[model samples]
Target chain A: MKRILAADIGGTTCKLGVFTPDLELLDKWEIPTDTTDEGSRILEDIHQSFKSKGDDHELNLAGVIGIGLGVPGPVDFNNGILNGAINLNWMEQKPIVSEFESISGIRTIVDNDANVAALGEQFKGAGSGHKDVVMVTLGTGVGGGVVSNSMLIHGHGGAAGEIGHLYVDYNRRFQCNCGKKGCLETVASATGMKNLAVHYYESGMTDTLLKNGIEAGTLSAKSIVEAGEKDDALALKVIDEVAHYIAVALSSLSAVTNPKYFILGGGVSRAGRMLTDRIEAYYRPITFPPAYENTEIVMAELGNDAGIYGAARLVKQFLA
Target chain B: MKRILAADIGGTTCKLGVFTPDLELLDKWEIPTDTTDEGSRILEDIHQSFKSKGDDHELNLAGVIGIGLGVPGPVDFNNGILNGAINLNWMEQKPIVSEFESISGIRTIVDNDANVAALGEQFKGAGSGHKDVVMVTLGTGVGGGVVSNSMLIHGHGGAAGEIGHLYVDYNRRFQCNCGKKGCLETVASATGMKNLAVHYYESGMTDTLLKNGIEAGTLSAKSIVEAGEKDDALALKVIDEVAHYIAVALSSLSAVTNPKYFILGGGVSRAGRMLTDRIEAYYRPITFPPAYENTEIVMAELGNDAGIYGAARLVKQFLA
Candidate 1:
């Protein structure tokens, strides 16, 4: 009765899941992430939580086949190194695979969180039936993961799917935290939408309900999306502007990876069809014809569970 | 002692190569492409030429393992379909694999010319020893091919490497043949360079050796590169502009595939260090940090023979 363990390690919490050898989820739980002491205690905390769970459930560690981890930064997949996760307060290359494997006496694999989330979607979410898929996660920052030939592409530096950093804002409207001006993340992420709203407000077009939020610097993507749903002009304009940049990024992605599905995930994507429809409108007229005609823009279905599922799927793929 | 044959099917001529199972080139030749009658006789002519070559060289058709083709158009690799090669007058889907196999009594594989060329470079040219590579072909038209994880990525609709179509010109300066405005191809291809020279001349910046040629529509990418070599201001300006757009496209490619080597090829690449150096300069500050730091821009070594080598590489991969 061998089992698999998956952990989606985030800044504040770690989501854990237990799966059978065949990848059926048996159990799932969460534990607060410890970020103090250079995040050195995080791995031990995860290991101890699994141990406690095992004891409570009469689960034996020896029966675990492997552990798969989704980390919150770029990963050297082959080497199993998590490279500099600032939010996790781990700014150095951590030997994730070796540490986890040694701690649990099981084989372990690690990949970037966004990449694993994409793998999760490709396996069971919106991209389930597609071999080629691009998952764009528009959360705090826009993130991307590309799957080609049914395998995640890590690129030469494990940076193959940094679609958020793609150059899109031609006017250099906002500077991305990635030290680049006019990145896709500057206008398409949750923060990017708010930035767009502020930009619109500053441009003397302040005739909207979002004006108070924009002026107070308290505008949220969720609020803007909610307003847009109610036919608010500024909110719709902001959504359209964000969708345009995203569409530009997707069009460029089409010319590069040309995936069958562009799965939109993250907080920003919760706007649903309103965002997707506008993105499709902007995407179709500009993307490479073959790709534009074939690729679909769909909402991600996995939500918060994508990372855990993707981690489990990584183990499944490894077993295969 | 089995052999593999590769054919690079272009509009004017088809370059053919014979190779051992080890992929060492044994012989190479060329035949004029008969693009008349909607390219109906193209496959048959290739088979006949191969037959003649085999007869003259004491080669037996049965000893050949397979034939690989590189066609100058979008290719449905799995179905062996050429979706529409306007230059070859192939306006409809042509069953290239079935037609070639039936005509020559050999197994066959077909891929896009730009894609195969990238595979060729990845196998033996500047990208040798690199699993992740991208090849940008700056010929009459800009073409691209991406190889990730040491394999060519044809995308869902076999349009993965259409880097030429990436939206780059923020000004929407020129209309692309792909029915899009502001495509990278409109500003980076050989003809694109000529168009830029014309645009510059029309805008009253005409104090160079290219003025008469631009006015007469006889301006060539070669003249521009040579003039740039001699520090001609107008030619340098055009080269810089082309490099800028190409760099923008490559930066976006970094966010997608993030290959280790960007192999520059086709006729315009012969401008050598003058072009690649400028492209690297523009690319470094803009692409994703990891990709920008790790990826190297290099010149294509195989030149005209890249297509044939790449075509043969396709068969080798198939056999594997």
Candidate 2:
């Protein structure tokens, strides 16, 4: 049975998985990313990990068809280059795919991590049944990927799915890490939820669980979601505000891409129906008629494994 | 010497054109749309126009390979159905392709006018030589079309490329024709420009050409552009404000679809470099880094003929 090697490389961790030709995951694991040398050792670590996994499973290395990698940055997929990956502390471009292929003796493919995750969901997760899917990951920052006609839209510079950077508010004073003001990420990410909580608390808007949590320095996106789940007014308000920003961004995206399904993933999305239900409520009123009626908002199903699955799926597409 | 017949069907007029297989316009003409009977005679008018053109030129009817049409509303391109084209009083779905094919004895294809126009630009106009292009037509209302990887992106319900409907301002109180408030169309269209002029005039801000034009009931998007060309204060303000909204919408779109070029068309685009120059100025600050550097904004080369040319391009694709 032939196998494929898949890797999802993030800023802090590198997730590796082995899958069969049929796409069944044979094994999966993670290792801390060694970013000490401008991420020069990262590819070497991934290669070593692949060899160790093969040894542990007593599998033949020659039986591996290819390796697929998802990197946390804009990827020049056609040229196999990772460009200015900030998280990995690489300020310059790197030949990621070539290095991995040379070390592992197998052909390799690479793409942006968010795009890979979207492909993962499209292939076997929440977006499996839909050919046109837009996946937004609400983690530390909002990340997005679009798959149209079953092909990922990498745009001209591989910067197509930067949904988090969408400017939602013009009057906002808070600056996004990207040096822009009013980015959707400044209001929709987990940190953005906490900012909303702090803004409300500093405005002296009332006594509520969120206010109390903020005063105690215990306010977090999760805590706010829990309080909202229990019907806390302040927490619900924060959730509604966050959901409003996300819904507006999604509505704007729908008008442009008109995807069939919007899959919400990442940490903040774990708030589940509470988040999606509110998003749909705000979305329906703002989206164009036909798109509003045709598109569906759903939650991610693969969780942490999405990147790995997406990476494997990349290999399948490459081989095909 | 084979040719293609093309029609751009709108609410007020029907534009017909004959083109060589290489897409060069051979001849073109227009007729008022007789929409009295649910657009029943629209197709017949197009047929008559094609026959008369053939007669006038003494061309062989057998040399025409196909006919392509661009309609005002949603289209199911696969089955050639135009769904509820409200502008044409087509409240009921109609099988447009078959009707035209049966009457002209030529194969027929149809698509939303915006999508077809984008294809036209992609094939031989401003967007020519680019595989991924986004075209936004700023007329009475804004309309848009997108081409990705050389194919039109007609979302799930053929509703993709509705860029005009993107919600750009949540605080806006003016409603769009689509029943939504804060849509880009509410601020970026020709009507939207007038509204902005009126907004500043009514706010009691200052003395400017726009104020005088409004007092004389001569205020128009064209007049405002003309004033801005001479550096009129209020007129430039209106132009800047409209450019701001369009830039924001384009930035958001770039984050999602990341097309290589944005082609601005329709009547208002005749404002020429006055409009595009400002749009690019405002676009740079808000767009994601790589996308901002890569995507270019330019005027449509085909002008009013874009729709007819686009319609003809559709036939070329079909025959290919």
Candidate 3:
């Protein structure tokens, strides 16, 4: 029974999963991320957990094949180095794989978390059976991962899937956190939705549920999506506007990569088919004809577990 | 020494070249495109030209290896099929590889001209020594080609490099020829520059050299570039505006593919560093910081010979 250890490292927590080579999860847990001391304790903590699997989960590590980690920033996958991961408080490049492999006596692999999530989706979620998939995560800020021909496109400097930074509107006066004006992240993320609702409310529009929510200080992307689902005009308008930006960005992406499926995930995607259906409606017309006919947009299935699964996939690929 | 035949098929003319395995051009010539019969005579003319190469240039075909073609449309590269090349009167999918291979008794390969041109640039032009390159041609219309890991990204339907159709301006009222509004092609092409000049002139900003050319019906993208070179304010404004659009589109592209270099080519690129330098100026601020720092924008060096050279490279790759 060959097994693998996988970790999805984030700013707040590190999710650890034990999986069989067949991709079946045997155990999963999380630990608070220790960002103090330049995150020096992170790898040691993971190694300790791996060694204590017998005590923690009644599972032995004697059959472990390797470890795969998904980190929240650019990664030099070829060298298993983490490059400038702000969330981890590591400004300098860190040799991630060697550190873990030295402790565990096993091979290790690391990749950007977004890219890992995309690979997870391609492997077992909404993008299953597709050789090419583009996954967009509409969270606090948008993140993306691209898999073409069943392989991740790491691009030069490992910056290939930075989808949220795409400039979507030249007219936007507000600057995105990335120091650009009108990035897709400013219009398509959960924060963007709230801002859009506020912008509409501030523009002298009244007599809408969203305005009422704003007046009550209860305005949120979830509330707006809930209202839009009920056919509220203002909420629907905000959703339509957000969908337009996302669809336009996806269309532009389609023209360049032409992936077979676009998997929408993250906190915002929990709005489910309401968001996907609207995005699809806007996507078809803007995409090039040939690509429009072939590419399909769908919601991700694995939810919060995608990252760990993707990390496991990374190890699986290494084994293969 | 073994040699190869390469053809770059265009609407008006088909350029043919003979190249040694090392990619040196042995001979080159062009013939008018006979697109009168669904482009049926096009291949025959190419074959006749190839057969007569010995008499015209003293180049014997006894050592010919293969033929590589660059066509003006989407191609199913695996099967060498051309899909709806409007410029070539090829509305039906044509099995170009087998057709040419059967006639010449040699292996044949086919790909979109833009993709081939990108490969050509990667092999010997400005993109030389780079494994990842994105080439944008601002001809009458914008055409693009992408190379990642030294392989052309054909996408799902071989329409991957359709960068021209990316919607850049949501406020645009005029539709592009692709039946979309605000496509990058609507602002980045030679025709797009002329249209921008007309748009500015129509907006009542008179007293410029471009206005005089427009009044004389001689306004062209080249004339606009020339005027900008002379520091004509309105022409510079138009050039700046066009450069802004190109920069934004390239920024969006960088966020996704993050190629090492962007190779700008075609008739509009004849403006040389004047255009590329301005585009880089605008691009740096909009692109993601890491990608902006690593990626460069440069001009293609092969000029009209790029397509033919790229075609020859295709055969060389096949041989390798």
Candidate of highest DockQ: 1
For model 3, residues A1-320, the per-residue Cα lDDT tens digits are 57888899998999999987888898988888899998889888887877777565455656777788999988887778888788989889888888888877777899999999999898889888877889999998999898876778877777888999888867665578878778888888988888788887788767687777798877888998888888887788888888888998899889888888889988888887777788888888777787667888888898878999988998888753
The interface RMSD for candidate 1 is: 1.0
lDDT of every predicted structure (CA atoms): 0.87, 0.85, 0.85
Native contacts recovered by candidate 2, as a share? 0.70
C-alpha RMSD values across all candidates: 2.3, 3.3, 3.4
lDDT (C-alpha) at residue A61 in model 2: 69
In the range B1-320, model 1's lDDT, one tens digit per residue, is 58888999988999988888888998898899888888889889888888888865456787888889999888999899998898889998889898888888899999999999999999888998889999999988899899998899988888898988988886778888889887888899898998898888888888888877887888899999988888888899999999888999989988888889898888888888888888988888777688777888888899879999999998989953
Alpha-carbon runs more than 4 Å astray in model 2: A1-5, A18-32, A48-65, A89-91, A206-218, A230-233, B1-5, B16-36, B44-66, B205-218, B227-234, B315-319
How would you encode candidate 3's per-residue C-alpha lDDT over B1-320 as one tens digit per residue? 57888999999999999987788898889999999988888988998888887565555556777888999988988778998789999899899999987877777899999989999898789988878889999999999898877778877667788989887766665578878778888888988888788888888868787877898888889899999999988788888888888998899889988889999988998888778888989888777886667898888898878899889988988743
Which candidate's TM-score is highest? Answer: 1
Question: How many Å off is the CA of B145 in candidate 1?
Answer: 0.2
Per-model DockQ against the true two-chain complex: 0.76, 0.65, 0.60
Model 2 per-residue lDDT tens digits across residues A110-187: 998999999999889998877788999998789989888778887766778788988786766567887777888988
Tell me the fnat of candidate 1.
0.77
DockQ (model 3, Cα): 0.60
- Local error of candidate 1 at A129, Å? 1.0
Model 3 docking category: medium
lDDT of 3 at B225: 93
On lDDT, who's better, 1 or 2? 1
